[model samples]
Target: MIQHGLPTIDQAWTAQQLERNLSRVLNTGVCNKVLDALKSPNADFQVIAEMLKGDPYVATRVVGIANMVRRRDGVAIQSIQRAVQVLGLRQVSNLMLSVMLTGPLLSAEGQLPRRKDLWRWVIACGVANNYIASQLGQQTDDNPDHLVGGLILGLGAIVLWAGLGQAYHRVLGARLRPMSLNRREMMDLNVIHTQVSLWTLEAMGCPDVMGEGLRALLAGGRDETYLRYRCVEVLGARIAGLDASDASAWLADGLPRLGIDQKHVENDLGVLRSELRQIGKIFEVDLGSWESQQAFHQKIMVESGQALASLIIDHLTMQESLGISES
Candidate 1:
């Protein structure tokens, strides 16, 4: 059994341990087959359709999403092959990856607090990232692969939570802001989620573009492409009721870098949000009604405050146990 504990910053994560944790999370052979299919050059409709047919649940989801895409027509897509054709290889791949990544978490017995919220945030980021890419008129290397990339980025957090189990829950309950989690995670685990995410993707044989996009998003440097993706991710997190404040600074710095004005970015984001809601339906993610959004926002604020108080208590208890004085 894997031991769960908060490690000091000096503790290093070994390659063997990383592989063991990744295996624990992705134990199924079907997931491996799907990942293999994703990296293949000839990942055409037939290849994906055949692979998806092996898993009834995943196939049903693909058909469901395909039908959702054809909304208002009332047409039933009963065939997985037809569904693949309707959604195209890129989109079909996106849906497949989303299922593979989230299936284990969904079926797990012990529920992680706010796991649904994290998933909702994941779907939003995936959809929003693709939408932002479209708005920019830039063709992504893998087309709609940004959707998968966004989901994989969110998976990093899930991996940490699930791998560390209860100890990680303590970290989550502390309710650090989304961006702040990076620093806190580094201080506690000696490795950030982005690094964990990259390692998992590489270990799983994910495509280069996924790793590239993640690296760019995490390391917000002068790269224009990286900044664009970072902006989209930040916008998606805000929509999911995570952290909205961090995006403003990114936008302030990024828009000028892209040679675009604030009005254009705002207009694009407005259109993107509407598109996101429609896309959210296909992904089955509830970004919430306006009232719900407000309620969620309030809940997050309250929880953050409560978590900070709890953290103070935890810290004082630890200090006292270590014989440290308040001074």
Candidate 2:
């Protein structure tokens, strides 16, 4: 049994209990059927495609990935088997496994109010990562591994929802995200959600790279891989409005520190949003909210820019009143 009311939203839970209870629930649906086939010694793309036969949602997404990514020709793939072949065995399995990790949690019985938003965040981050990574010529090991990294970026937040239910909602509902979210989780629950998320994914047999990427982020490493993950996370935060001020600061400061071209990413924003919304359809995520947030952020940026200019004018006028001059 999970602990929805282990404590009130503002209260804490013992770290020991969080671990024991969370471990019990991590053997997710992806751990069965499709994931099992992936773990099989003779795992093949055909075997994975067969496992997806009766599930139109998964099949559609398989073909969607084929059309959305693997195919540069914009030719639509209507056949799952052909989609599987185009995606290759490794790519297909990783995509299916990563998406399913947190996707099913959204539709599970007695979902939290914010689970859908979390789902949107996860998928949007993954898609944006793939888009950015591909644009930068990151091969992602010749697979859509960025999808896994994207899901991993805020995975703990979702897992905390599963472990603590509404109690987790306190953190979810807060404006803080990632490390700030981690701070609140530490303050309230005495457990870090990222650690829990990593444990849960490992228990579920997630890919080695998912663990490595997330761990690197946690350690504050500045390697190339870390920069890529960090950029995707910033994009995720902006899209989800998780930490708007921080994301805005990062945006204003420019992304060169993270090795991204701000102007290039800015130019691609339209196409990126479109592609994300299209991917959202596969998972039933309403990304229209993302657009709403986009408008809100832009408005804030304009207002802030105006305010700063006003401050400068005020300072210059005061200097003139005092008879101050540069020379």
Candidate 3:
């Protein structure tokens, strides 16, 4: 696996400090074992299934993806080994990584509903990114399953919340600002969550492609892989009904040289959405979780104005304390 570390001088928290914080927050005992097994050359379907059996979420999600892929028209796939066979090794690994990170962080407690909303957005993004990759793969006759980019999109937010706890909540709760989420975190926490997420993924021993895909999703480039990553990632949150104007601004720049447009997105995702629904039914995973996301956004608009005003004040005070020049 390729390792990418942040330049130490720019970081508010040193790399070691970030790791120490993440270690306390993420329950990686079972996760490390599972990922290790996934990476082992000797690991087979049965061996992988055995490793995952220890974690309820991983096991259930594995079966869910298997049945989701199967479409449930023939028969339900309940056995772990059978599930692995249906998904193939690579897809199963992708699904497992998707479930583990998204499952834990998005499950955090809150009346703010940010965690729940992020959960919905992240999962839907997994669906959307996979759809876009599949489209590109067909034309080039390459593997079409670039699913991890969408799931990793929220890694920075998840870690910020997990590591900083309520402190991160205050940052996100503040009224919508024109700044990118990265800038917001940099001002307050002296580190970018996406970078934290990238570092965390590297620390966790993720493959080079995942790390590369994340970078592409963040800054974008004209490389085919980067373009595919950007296509779904830039639009995933918007389509998922999350606030992501900062990320979506790329579509207008023509910097990445992407060709797909709004109509293309709606039409393509429409078909993929049906398949996502089928996976939800088969695996009971709620992969296409927009059912409640739209309603959540509506509720936030009506209920959050005054509350956000208070958070904005809190954020300004925090910036003052840290001497983050707002000029």
Candidate 4:
């Protein structure tokens, strides 16, 4: 069993045991078949990819890959065949298998709060991540994996939302977000989801380097991984076009934990906003649509609150038990 800050588990919540059970499930033959299909020949890519997409676990990965390949390769590609060519057979297979294995990480009995806003943020983050990758020259115009790191960045929150049921709602309502809350409050709200999601991803066969890099990025440290850099890039973009002081304040107070300096952050924010405008033009969406953007930010706050509430409850139980033992 894994030991969190809480006291030893009463024989039921060991990390080792959870890891063993999850590992076995992930290694099963059916899971392997799903992964194999993700790597199938182009003639079979669309059918299999679509089938995989039907599973919630695989949907983001499929979409991420398709987007990466199309954007980087610039091959005027419209199908999965082009995606595979852009991303290559190996990377696609790894992502597909990884997606299938992540299925069991979220418990089945929990109910999530608002999902629409969370999904929109996830998609936005993914888009922002890809744009950063493009700017960094990590991929050409056709590859989709460029944003793979960003799409699943919030998996930890999703896992918590899936695990805590209603306890999450009550606690998040009581604490964590009260208006103009600090970044520490957000972290306090989300730390459990962050840890559990990372552990779950590790157990599901993600390369430790990638998983750890992402964890570090979210946890806010000055790490040097590609994922970390990209996270900073996306975050900077999220608040771009706002007052420079406001954006800088977010960096000064909240984002430094992710290891980016304010100067670089401001610079990246400019680049990303410009790039986003271009992307918006391509998609025919108005990047500077003030009313819509305000609505979107409001929605993100509402949903992020729910996600935070779920995470807080999971950790609070641990904290509560520890407190009782200490008292």
Q: Which tens-of-lDDT digit does each residue in 1-327 have in candidate 2?
A: 233435533213323333344333332343367767766678887767766654443455566666656445645555667778887776777776665555435433364576655665676688668766776777854477776668766666665676566677876554346426666776667666556667656655666766776787677777876666767777766654456568767765446765567777767665655555555544453223433463354343324323322322232421132211223
| Candidate 4, residue 44: lDDT | 60
Task: Report, for every candidate in turn, its global Cα lDDT versus the true structure.
Answer: 0.57, 0.58, 0.53, 0.42
Residue 118 of model 2 has an lDDT of 67
The 10-residue segment of model 2 with minimum total lDDT is: 317-326
Q: Model 3 TM-score?
A: 0.66
Model 1, 1-327: lDDT tens digits are 222455432113423334454343333466568657766777777777777655544565666566545544655566778778888876776666666565434443365575645555666677667656665775643345666766677666666665565656655554435656666776666667667667666655556776776788667676876877666566666555456567656666765665556566556654544444444434442222322353354344324323322322232321232211213
Q: Given candidate 1, what's the lDDT at residue 55?
A: 53
Global lDDT of model 2: 0.58
| Alpha-carbon lDDT of model 4 | 0.42
C-alpha lDDT of residue 55 in model 2: 47
Q: Decide which is better by TM-score, 2 or 3.
A: 2
Which candidate has the highest lDDT of all? 2
Ranking by TM-score: 2, 1, 3, 4
Query: Model 1: what TM-score?
Result: 0.67
Each prediction's RMSD to truth? 13.5, 14.5, 13.0, 14.0
- Tens digit of per-residue lDDT, candidate 3, span 23-77: 4333357656777777777778888776665554456666655554554354666
- TM-score per candidate: 0.67, 0.69, 0.66, 0.50
Better of 2 and 4 by TM-score: 2
